[model samples]
Target: IEHSIYQIMKEDSLLYCLPKEPLQQAFRTNKLSVQGTVYGYVGWIFCQHFLERLGKEYLFLIHILDRRNPVGEEVLEKLKKRLHQDTFTREYILDIRKQYPSLLKVLYAHFLTGHYVNQAEASNQPTISYKRLTAMERLPGEDLAKRIKEVTTNYHERLVFEGFLCFNKHVLKTNLYQTTKVALSIRMDPSFLDEIEYPRDPYGLFLVYGSEFRRFHIRFSDVCRGGIRWIRSREREGQSINVR
Candidate 1:
């Protein structure tokens, strides 16, 4: 079956809530990873009830088990019963295992070391680190803008890179000073490399809207440079920055 990423994510949303303790327990004892893991179907059922009683604010979390988790045969049995034969949830977890083997491997390490996976630290690690990868820090305000500019420039120059085109920055104008807004704008391109069959960033222009004196505008620039657009004018008071 052809399943979209959104569909898979919808079925898998509940898996996010599994706690570190049960995960650790299952892994430590070499039990089936899903044993202590919450049932996806149960979570789904509870969410329906919760949505009526509580609202979207309250949600459920579930965890998928692998060999690395501290789950044993008994834990797996309890989960199977709770899942109540929801093939979709089972299939989703199975897909996660196949697609993200590294996640399971990392969980195993956590089980062995009795440590919860540290997302903050792990994300911080540089893609091209010389030494062991360390936690990457949040991109600072200026740093994000600078990175976007760099990416735009590279795309302008037609560099061999991915995600460069999607990178962007918005320059905000305020009474105090000009500020920055960073966001990624990813889209598929029709052009493709003949042999490689890879899509290239298309030629497009950026149109910025908002204030200049107060620095209240979003800056737009092309990922792959060919055309450029600018509107450096301001709108009247109490009115939104016009798009031109």
Candidate 2:
């Protein structure tokens, strides 16, 4: 079943949202560290496309934030079955509270510390360090240590690594610029685009929307230094509409 789905994705040229020249150039240059935050079915579509194009030589890492919710659990189960068959792919379910306790503590403290007068003042404000917060929380029940060891032990030093992360929903605080080289945000409804602020400094941003025509449209925007350069648009029929 997964193989059939993968073949469908590979054969569907319309699913390739990125510009041909740029994508080819990225692969040719061996800049293969690609990551995104997945929300739902559209996210899965993009992941399949990436894996099909990147081939089985690249390592694919999937991070899941929630495993208890039924919808998320279903997605995880499907991903496990799909990814397990691929020898190079790996999946990690991150317990945020356990994985990032100190970071969370600092964030909590920062929010509770009080409001600053301005951006400059906020930068200079003295606050309690994360080290003084508490001890590092261990990840229990899951063999995260063994997974990490396996990743390190079997990892090739020269092979490029690619990663994918599925979040229950989009969070305003996610630092996409620092974590992912290219970030793809999926929105099933196009109406919400007006309310969201685009990221200022990501190498690439693919805003995917489900149109009323029952077609998926991708708006490619290159963001750098607080400016956006419209690249191109891709329609569900494999048509390239130049937006710039």
Best by lDDT: 2
On residues 83-160, what C-alpha lDDT tens digit does candidate 1 reach at each position?
333322323333333332232333222222221222223345422111111222234335434544454333312221
Model 2: per-residue Cα lDDT over 1-244, one tens digit each:
5433433342232223332222233333433111111122233233333323223322222233355677876865565545434433222212212233233223323322221112122344422222222322333212333333334323321121111221112222322112122333333222223111223333333444221112233344533343224333467432321110
How much lDDT does each candidate structure score? 0.27, 0.29
Ten contiguous residues minimizing lDDT sum, candidate 1: 170-179
Error of 2 at 213 (Å): 7.6
The residue pairs that clash in candidate 2, if any, are none
For residue 107, model 2's alpha carbon misses the true position, in angstroms, by 23
Residue 6 shift from truth in candidate 2, angstroms: 38
Model 2's TM-score against the true structure: 0.21
TM-score of each: 0.16, 0.21
